[model samples]
Target chain A: MISFFNVSKVYPNGVKALQGVSLQIEKGEFVFIVGPSGAGKSTLIKLIFREELPTKGQIYINGRSILRMKRRDVPYLRRQIGMVFQDFRLLPDRTVYENVAFAMQVVGAKRSEIKKRVPEVLKMVGLEKRMDDYPLQLSGGEQQRTAIARALVNNPSTIIADEPTGNLDINTSWEIMECFQEINDKGTTIIIATHAKEIVDSMRQRVIGLERGKIVRDEHRGVYANATT
Target chain B: MSTGVYMQMLLLRQAYYIFQEVGRSLIRNSLLNFAAVGTTAISLFVLGVGVLLVINTNEIAKTIESDIEIMVYMRHNLAEEDALTLEPLIDNISGVQETTFISRDEALKSLVKQFGDEVEESVGEENPLPDTIKVKISDPREVNKIAAEIEDLPGVESVRYGGQDFVKKLFSLTNWVRIIGLLLITLLGFCGIFLIATTTRLTIFARRREINIMKYVGATDWFVRWPFLLEGIILGFFGALLAVGVLYFSYGALIAKIQETISFLPLVNSSAVLFRIFEGLLAIGIVMGAVGSTFSVRRYLRV
Candidate 1:
């Protein structure tokens, strides 16, 4: 569902984040994009969401060129894809339910639909009982779960998570990974960019490795190899 | 439901959400919003009072101008019949409203009233007061021209009126008052807008994370903008209402006392003037609120 052709990104300060990268991922595939810091993993993910434009090539999502899309159409594109971040960007003042319901409200979902779906999504993340609690009132893992619940409440076709477990303990990281596994099992495509070598090796999914702004390896049922070659 | 009905329902739902967001933010940043509203109220209040002052000053100027009268003194040795003939000539002047002939005897009577019975007895039967034609003009500003025309008329000695310099000074003073009042209102209006804009900018900056989250969730630009715009309008409107209430009671009491003690001073009718000022203040308040928020929130809504 995503294709990048000869994509290159160079910052104004002369740092080349990505250079001549090309890749394709089919729908309904849970893929891991593995790389070290400054290895173009985040830049690749940002390009998919049109957060930053490719400097030298076209990126397509579902047969449409995102590089050619009008500025106003970006929001509709975002609505079809959910995003999770390492920080669990929940409004501290709002309750868990509000945090999740906010996503649906942004898409103008009916009040009834939001009421029906928020609890179901929270249940999937295992936080249904704490829906009334604010983000600050929850543990780190629980807060991450609430963010995941918010991401899922939109019922998007794809989920792009940027280091979703970077701040969590190893145990909490496994739990968050399990939540992603459950979501993937239900047929939503998942793309994760991460540095967690153990989780990457254990998942045994399609892995694309990046090194020095270039994709060094693409393997099916891959292991997280340390060397660039 | 029909499509039109469905659309209306959607609009109503959206309005409810926007207003709910406005209420939430208002409470969230109550202190800042309170200061914004208070500044707006004071600005509008000062503007309203300045407008009323200008209106009343104009009214007073008009009253004074209307009371101006020209005195056409007849020649000292002119016959009584000849002096009476000058009445129609004075009345026919372009600016003259009307002219009344005051006989020597009537002039002597007014003189005696001013100088007492000793003067009356001293001039008994020898009435030395000149026969005069009292002239009222349509416009006080036209007094110099009409007085000059009457001075050249036959059987007239001199034309006398109140201080021309003083009349000119009154007109210039009122003009300056109006100009300065308008300038102050404009300056205060911009000050209020600036304060509101800064307050809104700070509030939006504080909630920028929430806004970023909203953008990531695919909220449309207008969806994000509506609540902030409504917040500004509500603050502005509430401030204006407070100012209007204060102006109505205080100005009414002050005008009442002024009228009681200084009965001759001309003041504009308070109720109608206050009502007009209230409407103007509300309009200015709402516009300032909307405009201030619109400009302040623009830079942060790049998403």
Candidate 2:
């Protein structure tokens, strides 16, 4: 579960990214944060990861105040939340299996555990056959799937994705959404900030609309927009 | 497997990864690494030479300190009794340890022994050398003070210490060398660190995406830091090693040449002094490397 109370973030350049926002994401919920450019979706996602500290508010993940945690404790908080990006940031030189296994390797997981879990996660994301290939050898969807597998390798409680489908086509975006749905079905909360109108409207998951650092509307099982709010 | 054994294997794997990362970055930025190492080596080399010169100077100073004496030459018209009376008065000075008087004949004989038969042949029977009193002082550093006091005495012609005025100048010059060497070392050390920091910063910038990925995947700051720190250490170690190795061989050759040509000059044992100096240089190199990499990486890690 993730909760934010009156969270506000102002960049050093005096850009207000988020302000007076309060929300809660229950366990296993699928959340899509939809907004136009510069609408604080990225900042909201970064806040969840604690990438940027909130200028004025409190945040709790699994009922623990993230604002109170020291710098040393931030990494542990991040461990509970997985992150994906629009660039499909996979190490180009590493093979698919190595890429996924690396996430576990860095956190010092056991070899047997990595060997067993990496293949399992890759299979779930349907990239098991491409394990030997490098990311450059794979298509856009496959690379993004590899990233998903990497994110899931650690079994984080919440997976936060910022524009995961921004670089893909309509079909590829659906495929990535289905992958997130499958993970969501398996009891991991998935939160995505995206500009995909069709995906949000057709899937009709919980949609929160933001405009100029403020949440305008939040609806369960809602489309991207309801006739311009 | 036993838990202890498993933990050991894990540690070994961790060590392997850190080294592999270090090796990878070193090879990846070989040009920059070479430049940093070469630059650091030259600075350390010059610093080492300065240190050796200072060490030799201090050794010469120590030898001179033990034998330091004020040579008091008497006026030629002074009687033997007046010169003898001057010695007792000179000995009354608080710092005077001993006063040995030498007659004109005795001075000529010792000069011939020093300059070979030519000294006696040049003098013939005239014995132009002046009678002298060698005044040994309790403190060699006080030679100037004691010499001035003796110079004022009526029978004494002049008082001389440190062989000639230039030898005293050499001591002061060496003190300047030491001071300048310290300042130069500090400046070079900063440059060495800055160079390493630049190389590592470039590496960090190049591998920035991987760092972002590492951070996202829950890798701790230390997990990212260890490789860069090890890289800095490796760079520093190799640079210092290059410098000290050259210094050792060059110093040995220089010492051998000095012994052959300038036999009068006394030198400290090179091995012990060089060992101590090399140890210090290598340590400085390592610290430069570590601090450089740490400084560069700290900026990016703040994210």
Top candidate when judged by DockQ against the true structure: 2
| Interface RMSD for each of the candidates | 1.3, 1.6
Candidate 1 lDDT over A1-229, as tens digits, reads 9999999999888899999999998888989998889999989988898888888998999788998898788888888789999999999988999999989887777789889999999999999899999999999999999998898898888899999999999999999999999999999999999888899899999999999999999898887884554
Candidate 2 local Cα displacement, residue A31, angstroms:
0.4
TM-score value, chain A, candidate 2: 0.98
Q: What do the candidate models score in CA lDDT, each in turn?
A: 0.89, 0.88
CAPRI grade of model 1: medium
Tens digits of per-residue lDDT for model 1, B1-303: 998988787777677778888888999899988898898889888988888888899999989988899998998899889998888878888989989999988988888899899998888777888998899999888899999999998888999998899789988998999899889889989987887788788888988998899888888788888898988889889889888888888888889999999999999875666687789899999999899999888887785
Stretches of candidate 2 exceeding 4 Å from the true structure = B1-13, B57-68, B73-99, B103-105, B111-131, B137-141, B151-168
Clashes per candidate, residues 3 or more apart or on different chains: 0, 0
Give the lowest summed-lDDT range of ten residues in model 2 chain B: B162-171
Clash pairs detected, candidate 2: none
Task: Show the lowest summed lDDT stretch of 10 residues, model 1 chain B.
Answer: B268-277
List candidate 1 stretches off by more than 4 Å. Answer: A5-22, A52-57, A63-72, A208-228, B1-3, B79-98, B113-117
By TM-score, the best candidate is: 2
